[model samples]
Target: MTWLRALREIVRSGLTIERTRLEPLVALRAAAGVAIVIGLALWLVSPAYAASSALGAFSAGAATFQRSWRPRKVIALAAGAGLALSTFLGYLAAGHLVTFLLLLATWSFVAGMAWAVGPTAGIVSAATVAGMLVIITLPTSVGQALEHAAVIALGGVVQATLILLFPIRRWGAHRDALADALAAVADYARRLSHDPTAPFDAKPMMTARSAAAVTPSQARRRPAALHGPRGLAERIRPAVAALADPRVGAPAEGPGRDRAREVLGAAADVLDAAARSIRRGTPAQVPSGAMETLRIDEGDEVLEGPARQAAVRLASLLGEVLETADSCDTHVVPAPARGAADAPPLLRPTMFRLVPVVLRAMRRELHRDSPVLRHAVRLATVACLGYALGTALPLGHGYWAPIASVMVMRPDFHQTYARAVARFTGTLVGVALATGVVQLAHPDAYLSGGLAVVSAALSYLLMRTGYVASQSFTAAYVVFLLGMGGEAWDQTVRDRVLLTLVGGALAVVAYVVFPAWETPRLLDRLADWLAANGRYAAAVVRGYGDPAGQRRADVRQALLASRDANAAWGEAFGRAKQEPVRHRGLTRREAEDAQEAVQSLGQAAMLLETHLPERGARPVPEAARFAEALEADTAQAAREVRARRNPDWDRVEEALDAWEGADSGMDPVVRRGAELQLQALEELATAVDRTPLERDVASSRQERHARAEEEEESRRERDTGPAPPPKEEG
Candidate 1:
């Protein structure tokens, strides 16, 4: 029995190992490098090491192949290949170790620059360039080196081939799982639209929305990952981007479709909320009829237990959706009614008048002495200094400069400093390990190859975990290359340790100088976001429901822009928090209000899309009035934080509610448009204050359904000829 249990465990372990696919490929490629190392030790280096390195590199390439169907992924992979090849040629041309190191450092800078565009491209570029440079510059005979390079190329080819061979079953599963999750979220959105009792907390909504965004990615590359959260975000990144686009919000046309869309949006919000609540140790509940409104599909079956449970929990939140109609303060709030103190000082010459004051204020806020600017300056300086010191160092072989640069640069003081320390420590440890292995094994070709393979495998595992792991793995490869270069393990270890420290120190010094504050940039982004949303809201309010094609396109673009702005705003504010107040261009409360206003606009746009067509043909009087009221409300909301005394939220809500409810009479197009617009506005308002109107909407739906069922029963009874309906047995 014990033996059987042990055998089962062994099989499972092997299966797991095989599943990763990176391990074996790493080991194989490492052997190629190992052969060179052994030959260098014996002065009879073989070409086999090149093949091994190629294979290892190729396997590393395969790791990213998991994201292969995506164009972005393909582009990233291609860029990495190009960068590595370019770095190698540069190293070959220079021949001098110092020159090679400089080229490698340049490669690192390029990689960092690319990172601002995309993460995958940046990492791949960094890794390939660093690796190739090490291989090209390392000590080896011409014949042996050529053969090794060939083998390495072969490895890359094989890795790419392997990626294409098997059907990736995980792709569909991931997609389906994501879809199910989104569907659950949609259910919650629907409840919130009608039910005013919904919790509708912003944090939870954000969280759930974030989670829902992961589906498109999962649908694309479902890697054969045994159920775990590892690499989940990376896989779903693209899908998240797509979901943020509002044009995709086209509601199904026909009866209940508008209602369904409202439901879906609210459900999405609820799912977002529940996901958040779950993190905070409580789960949100769904309202009654939440699930009934959503279009459930078999794709939902793809979710495993946890995802299913999450969906169920999210559904429960719908039951508790807010009933906010009663909270509507049916009062008209005057527009632009500012107090004397609330007004900005009159500018005699406009731009010139405020220029001096603005400049003085900005100088005081964004001074070089400010912590935020100081941090940015330090980050850039550290990167530059790391490069300079690495160029000066007598580091034997490879691109120490680039490696040092990556280790030294950071988003902030702690990260920059911490990375440098980690890099130094990891390098020293790696060198020591390499030296010990060389001494104990006596540099036999087989043994060296084995060690190389082991290092590659370890690197693949460590890369995703964090930079420290990657740093150590890089050191192991460096040692292997040095061995191939005919350097003794002890000398290689000593040189590596010293140069790493030098590079690290230089990077640290650079970071402390000329820090660039990002606070102003964040504010600028927020302002841009606000302006874009304002335009979108204006377009929607003015032209709801009419010519479908052009208007839809405009509204869709606006919606997408608004979502992008929200995302950008969130990221900007999050980063700004690390900086001092002086560096922050916008006040915290002001920023919050801006986000809220944009969100309200989004809701308003949705409402117009829904109700405008139905009510558009009605008497132009009320519609025109509603438009004016909406515009006024929006302007007020935009400047809400800047007001001397906070305006009445209740009055704002009431005006929006009343405007949304105004009848356009029996015109279906106008009625639907109005209803949709109203529903959307109500939701946005309810977000701030749980209005009873939402609840009334939900109850009305229930009554309508009941009445519908009753009518059907009565018709059936009449058709059956009434007397025969009674039980004959009685």
Candidate 2:
């Protein structure tokens, strides 16, 4: 990408508004928490102290609204504590410029690294950096600083207390995650009737699993409905895929295909009903009518072989789903159990015990190539340099400079650049609004406080709508906050605007110096996804060859690993597309094609998973050898892919040919399925090896050939009148 194009993209992305449903009530509630803190502080101390308290309360409440799985109150409390601590430390060091800058650098770096934990943690920590810069300057003495810090902590306390008193949809995120998982499966089932090769989205399931990881305290209060259905959905995916697949379960046409379609539709209905029940925390009564299709009648044509087994399994699981998705207040239903040898349960430690866990996660990102590590280095450098430059310039707005840098810079290239552009735009608008208010109406203290609250409320409501909107309100809130404290905002707004531009410039330039572009990581991510997909596919295929020795738990773990790798590659690919770096080895078209190939590889494995034979059933004689070869070949292919070399699947072909030459003894069904797996592997190899030049040449030749054929057909039509329409494929 050229610099001009990149700049245009950054500006466009920065200004793009997201269309999210407005939740006025939630925003109002959080605003009320800020208002309460402000009102109390004004009644007791003064507006200056009230501004500090409001900053703390508003920041805490904002953090709670971020994408966190924990209870909102817990997030509020954690944010408050972090803000209080940073506030206290920042003030203590503020007495010396050298000391404060060093501390600021360290704090900013830690805040950047916090992203390794999650977005919620990372964002809350960034808020702390802002609080340290903006909120700490109010205190004059050490004693006053301590008092102000306590007030900031109190602000968080008020927000948490308000949330506890009037909660809005408790465990709402968790419910949505689980409901979405079930809904995705339902949608997949529906599509399978018409498109047998429909691929399942792993994102919803991944989200549900993340939501299921609960601290002991959370586990105690978690609803019964959220516990059991996720596991069932995971198990049902393979069964449904198998039943719809022509090679494995049902015939391509005839009575069996019709039965498969009917079973799929019925499964979709039941899953949808269960989803609604779980989401609403209602009784599972909605499935009563739709559940009958799951029952095998005396004359039903669909009840036979693997299709019959899958239908029966689906019915049994739906029964479990109905049994679990209800308003059961008796005892919380236990989460599904796995074999002792399976992966550990999704248990989270108490928040107090999360320090080590977070540290370990951060530690893992300490490597040179880690984006989180590079972001930390970039953040620290920009923050410190921005502060020095801001202080040295005519506009000595310490908070404005560093806060702009801290808020705009993200771990990814696109966001960092986009946010820097957005930050400047938002700052200008916000500062202009503040300046207008000052010039037009010099509101009294109470009115200024009210205006600040209103501004904050607007920010909360629009946080997810766009970076520009929320950031504008946030900037205006700070101005109004200072205005409430008897500050001369007319001149201050101009200074802040200048410093904001400087800060944004610093952030953008810093990224270029300490770059962490996703382009370089794409190959690594692709290799990882390829290897993981191989292992997962191999595991599923091996189960058919060695059913007695197969561990379902191992297969399940492999599937999870593959999904994780797929997600990682997807994230990198998305970021890489937006980045302005040179393409590394693989072009954009090749990357996309390779992704599709890997997806097909996983989809084929999913189909195989649906038909693993019982232990006593006969296994294909050469299946084990073929599966072993596939595993080794794909692993090697992954290594080659990382080096930008075409993968050789000669070993895989040899194994398949050997199986084919000797498969006179194997069942035709299993034999055909193995061939399907081989075909998917070959497609993956072709996808990875084909160059853009080759594809373009091939397409051009095909288009010319097609035109010549069309001319010949037209000539025939002129000579023989309109030819009969070609018959459609059966």
Candidate 3:
């Protein structure tokens, strides 16, 4: 019954689907591309060639359209060449049993390795494998193969030409990415306005940051003058958070609170307007009276001390946001500020490089006991095995098995199992539907071709929604595609269903036998995150008293590393939770607490970085000393996490208490920033301390209960008498 429940859970998870607003547009683009290719092939060539050409065009265009211009050109050419090469190889290997098997296995292995290059290369490689299967199954001579390959290549050319000629949605993705980042910032500000203590959700902002960061850096292209919106958002986040800090004394009630709320609300409106303008490529019109709301009177008695400080900080950040939005709206880069050259380079090329640095990364992974290398090898092995089994068995359309295997297997056990279930179930439904359509309607070549185009478009549209919907459309597309190419649907439907089941089973078996379980790796991932945060905190603290003109490149690097580490830990933890109860290394509560601690540490570091006073501002020696002490304490906490021991917060707490009494005689803004940073550090330390303490308490309680049970058992045995055991032995 337990096993049944687990299976039911897996099925439910696999079936769950989601759709985004962009689906209709994506579907339309894909459908139009395929439809045009099919129309051209039907007009200029035979129906048999039309099917193969349309398939090639659809796959290549779907993969390349969203990329930048240069990459799109490269992908289009590479994908077309891959298709041609695969078709040629298929013709040369057909009917020769040994040669055919060897060719398929070798291609499968190469395709698996192509994933190490990058996603675009991986997509093209998979498309090539599909092309090979299609061409190999049909009888062809050298001349006929050449003609077929040319038509397929021509199809790719058509897609690329359309992109060049139409130019619709140019830079639309980039615009949307930046818009989303601004909108996320506005959302955060609104939340802060309502309750300074409101839980901050950083996931949306992080996702938008990642998207905006993906723009390719090319020497020939004019760089977008301003840094990504993420930088602006990061600079603003701490100020918003500081407004809610009780230590900052940002008025919890009365007229001051109302004024703060009004400012935040108005700022949010301006940000929303900016995002809308960027997305629509129009001039940004600041909301009426928003600038007026941001204006702070110098001598307002009600806004004294911390409230005054918060209002000033909020006004400054809002001004920066407005300037950035105006720059984006006008399509003009802002002039470099005085001493801009001396400022730290915040937007580095490491993340935005056009050519991926994956090869060097893969090489490094191969030198260690890396899960990436293990997964790659496993994928290649499984792909070859699936191909050999399908070919050796008496299954018709044997290529489907290997394709299914390649599509279903992932680096992690969780995804592999989930995808296997989804793929098999989707295949069953798709085959039944396709089979029924063929039997009832007896569709001709033209109808079948149109149906194939529609299904292909739908598959690409729902690709991100989940595996099941995408697979269902894909299976239906394949059925219609083969039918249009003169294969009877009746004969292919059963083979598709059986082959998918076999492939899914093979994928599951492969992972079960040699799983890369995330449970054992969870601790290491968490430790890495802690170490990264520690380094980030240290860098920010060390630079707090540095020359105002100095660049903090180290801080930026550490922040990026910490973000990457956090993401890695989150992925590993999520997979670990989905494993069986006995296999889970940490409880859900323990993981969540640790995650919160790491996030708090990151927030503290950001606060310290932003708190550093500008040139000519008063410096607080006490603040600098406190920051250094906090840095050392954070490092110690990281070491403790690595050692799987409780963090010692006693010394850190004492330092914080001592700092509270020390008078720095600094400006209110600097003092408030320092207070917020110190408070955040304390929160982080407390959260870190709670994890091991809770675990110890739970352990002690369990031990006491066990001891009580043993005592009860002894009493029961004494009452029953020991003579019964001896009598049984005699």
Candidate 4:
């Protein structure tokens, strides 16, 4: 009876352990990896070890943690997880050196598969996983590789557990950064509107429009409950963006930084108001002193430097918005359609949309004359040299070829140079650390094995830090492996130093010779993006008369296109910072152009809708003349914009002249149409001045909505459905 009771207790414990130990997929990977290591260790081909497999598993788990923390589409997260887990399992099951190599290749293939399906998230995972796998599987052995595999799997499991259970506070930090940015934009807007001394030209308009453009979507996706202060920061990205208009230029009082903060603060206020409107289903009408709201009293306030400037700038922007709202003589436009038919033809196709063009343009600027490409070429050349030396030295392991390639190829020249220097320096330090551990401990299988675990831990810590940390760990692991193989310290040190110089030299050569130009490519890409957006905006106008179904389709496509373009521009700008002198102004002009186009399209859509009932109102020749003059000015604006990336002063003057002339001599109907067109042109000009795409898109949507509503009203009146009397136009 006692034995039976003990057995029952044991069974219950086992069941609980099985349920709580690991996720089913993860458990299966651990089990499978262990099985392969056991098989290979038994085979014992020479002094085979299991560190590589251990590293692989650890890396995969680390990737899983990275993915789970980000906001991703459901399919992306699932596919990314499956691919990473499967790679771990594959590495574990591969029993021979060739099998291990195949496993590494398979891991990359799987990660790529996920990337192919998921876009940004998938590609990032694939690159990291592939890079790590190649580093671990250098010698590629089936026999005696299980131990390495197990260590790697254990490291991975621990990392995954820690991230899932503890959750890092970094995401919160990012959120805060974004919030700070928003406050600055809002403050700037307030200043723009209220400051009597400030310029009332397109500069203020651009700043105000950009702020409004940036506030909406950013207010939607952030999760404040999870991130707290940091989340609040992220939620203000749009608000921060509002402060980025180029016309704001340098602030007069102190440094430009303070102005930026003021602008951001005003943007934040607007966002707060906008968010309230969204939540409560009530719109915040534009205020009269919106322009004055942005006025910065240089004499007042406790804040100094960039913070004060940013606050003032935001205040000005808010003032501007209020004024614009109060002065609006026409109706606000409705949202654009969310369908392809309602959007531009270029956007109808999901692939090769507007964004790529923008990206490509940015790329062209830097890459066309890129120092980075020269550096890459130099590095590739040096890698070939190392390969020759490694083989000639009779070490005959072509393994260093890829190592040299990986270590030297910087994403940019500065990074490449730093990494090369760091890799060589860290290699010396790592080899020394390994020698000290081996000498003091006189390593046994257990002691050497313990060192392996330590190496995994070090790798895990270094994993998120940066390239230097990763390289440091790689060197440490290599030194440990050398010790495990019973190599003499002196000989190991000599070989390591030699390879370090070889790798470093090779990398420099590649970097110098195979430069990857990033800027010019990005500019051309941005141009292409603008062209595509132009087409999409056009389609949206054409479909404005269609039912809600068509409008919905167009709006979605346009929104997606705009988003893609925005994201591409963000990345391109990040790349641009590396070569600001070369590519700084390339996209700035195009962005401005797109903004104007969006405004024009929006106003046109609204006017057409207003006249839908009056399409039968007949062409009043006087009104037609006014409309024609307005159209001519728009055409001239477009041509001038297309010819010059910056504001074409002559063309702008001509356009304003035409607009003023047309405004003076027109029938009421023509006058209204002319005014709408002029308003759109001004808004478009404002967008160009700001250089942010979001403002242009928002303005365009506003136009589309106005047009849609007008058309619907006309149809309803004609159809005579029960309806209220038309409200007086502003």
How far in Å is the alpha carbon of 466 misplaced in model 1? Answer: 4.7
Ranking 3 against 4 by lDDT, winner: 3
| Candidate 3 backbone overlaps, count | 0
Query: Model 3, 623-658: lDDT tens per residue?
Result: 456556656776676677656665554444455456
Query: Which predicted model would earn the best TM-score?
Result: 2
Clashing pairs in 2: none
Better of 1 and 2 by TM-score: 2
TM, every model? 0.54, 0.90, 0.82, 0.47
Given candidate 2, what's the lDDT at residue 530? 89
Q: What lDDT tens digits, residue by residue, belong to model 2 across residues 401-489? A: 87888888899877877788877888888878877886788887777888899999989987776667777888888888888887877
Model 3 earns a TM-score of 0.82
Overall lDDT per candidate, in order of appearance: 0.44, 0.81, 0.66, 0.42
Candidate 2 global CA lDDT score: 0.81
- State the lDDT of candidate 4 residue by residue for 524-603, as single tens digits: 44444443343343333333223232443454355345445545555555555444236444455645455445434433
The model with the greater lDDT, 2 or 3, is 2
Number of backbone clashes in candidate 4 = 180
**TM-score: model 2 vs. ground truth:** 0.90
